[model samples]
Target: MAAVFLKLDRFALRQFNTAKYAGTRIFFDPDTFESKVNEYYGERHALETEFGDRPALVQGYAPFCRHLFMPNFTGAKVSVQRITAENESLLRTRYEARRPNELPVLVRFFPSEALGGESALPVARYLDVILYSREQCLKEAQAMGEEPPLEDAPWRIISIKAQDEPYETPMQPITIMRNSLIGEGGSGVPLCRKKYAEAVAYWRERAIIT
Candidate 1:
């Protein structure tokens, strides 16, 4: 089985939801998706000759999920279902509970990128939820050692405020994807953190502003 990783940045989740439904402004480029894909997979020989050796690039779920959620509601919802299935049985139950009114949707299963195999990865899964209070959010973050920012802070911080809080209430799961870190070069060094940081930096530099 492939290992999957989950990344839940509270700041990014807030930004995603706000921009998604409230007409808030967030910076992202649709065309960068292709640029990003090329960066991860490596440049074409023709493009490389034209542009010279570009920076070693990496890509990950955060930005990809953001792009995917914009116009693809069904896909986003299904992704949420997969993640929810892992923990709360209620989501699956509720989904099934409404099968009379809600029709089943097809979900695509792509091979794990980290494992480079045809089998699905089962490491970490992604989820986005909104809580009722900043206090609650802060509490969860503190438990996870991911405290939110003070009112004056400039950078956005996402934290698991409370581990014991109910998964229900105002919170609703958004999208989920399996994550994993796989080592390259047989040295047995874990490369997930390095790749994740590289991917984050790539987007940060592009001013893609996530």
Candidate 2:
């Protein structure tokens, strides 16, 4: 099966709620999305500047879809995992300190250029959907003081990023994709970090990347 991965912040969580609770799919043009990312980067950069100006880890690429991409609402194979508040801190630590060997393929899936919101995006090629069991969905709905749906249907959280600020309340439960180290693709497009390194080395050996 084709598997895609996703990451969710607060805003993304909200969008997910809309999809599951209200049944809507929010779409954006590439330019508008890019603007939002730039605005966020500017705000974040300003705050970081106050602390101490440092070089950026990613220079040109916008940090917009660092986690997830969904190709379609239905008929897509996806894996989901939720980054809970408890593990959030640990995740941050690990992300910062991740060794090449430890880094997962998703985190290391850097594009050659920034994804400028093109229509023919990677959603079909390399995206994952978030799914939840019926029980989990009902539990979350009750927690939010909302009535759960009558049917015990599974919930598929759509792709959305959290807002610039932290979410005020606890989020509904969600899941993330499992780590996929190697997947079928073109030579330069291996699925995981180790294989990515190998591909890079292979290309360098063949004078592909100098």
- Considering every candidate listed, which one attains the maximal TM-score? 2
Q: What's model 2's lDDT at 179?
A: 21
Residue 210 C-alpha lDDT in model 2: 4
lDDT of 1: 0.26
Give all candidates' CA lDDT scores. Answer: 0.26, 0.28
Best model per lDDT? 2
TM-score of each: 0.20, 0.24
lDDT of 2 by residue, 172-195 (tens): 111111222211111122234544
**In candidate 2, residue 159 scores what lDDT?**
37
In terms of lDDT, the poorest run of 10 residues in model 1 is: 177-186
Against the true structure, what is every candidate's RMSD? 20.8, 20.6
> Which ranges in model 2 have alpha carbons more than 4 Å from their true place?
1-123, 154-210
